[model samples]
Target: MKSAKAKATNYKACLALEVPAYVAFYKAPPEFLGDDALTIEVKYQGGRTEIQKITVKVSAPGGQQKI
Candidate 1:
């Protein structure tokens, strides 16, 4: 069995993608969802609005991870 500290460390290393808007939608039926998987609206440098979608998969860590 893993030690308590080791388990805590392992969980800390794991990263989860959290999108407040998509949380509720993800729980809903797929038919009601839109084409965009995960979208984040941000204001660019010059007061321009832009929408960006990031595709991510939840998986166990084997090697290095991206931020």
Candidate 2:
């Protein structure tokens, strides 16, 4: 499927009775460690918009490994 970018103000006249669905994926680099964050902007069909910030912590694996 193709993705299109549209402005929220353009759909101000539109409305939705049901919630929309979204799919997202995230992966950290193998050498990455410490604090990470993700910022997300959500636009509703009614033209309302919301911004969310999520923080994530990455640390080295603990415990012993057996062969």
- lDDT, model 2: 0.63
Runs in model 1 with CA error above 4 Å? 1-36, 45-47, 61-67
Global Cα lDDT for candidate 1? 0.43
* Model 2 error, position 67 (Å): 31
Candidate 1, residue 29: Cα displacement in angstroms equals 17
User: How does residue 9 of candidate 1 score in lDDT?
Assistant: 32
TM-score of each: 0.30, 0.54
Cα lDDT of model 2 by residue, 1-62, tens digit: 22444334435566533333564545668988777888888888899999978776766777
**Number of backbone collisions per candidate:** 0, 0
Which residue pairs of candidate 2 clash?
A: none
| Weakest 10 consecutive residues of candidate 1 by summed lDDT | 1-10
**What local lDDT score does residue 37 receive in model 2, on the 0 to 100 scale?**
85
**Which lDDT value does model 1 have at 30?**
40
Candidate 2: stretches off by over 4 Å: 1-20, 62-67
Tens digit of per-residue lDDT, candidate 1, span 9-38: 334656544333322223324444233346
Using lDDT as the measure, the top candidate is 2
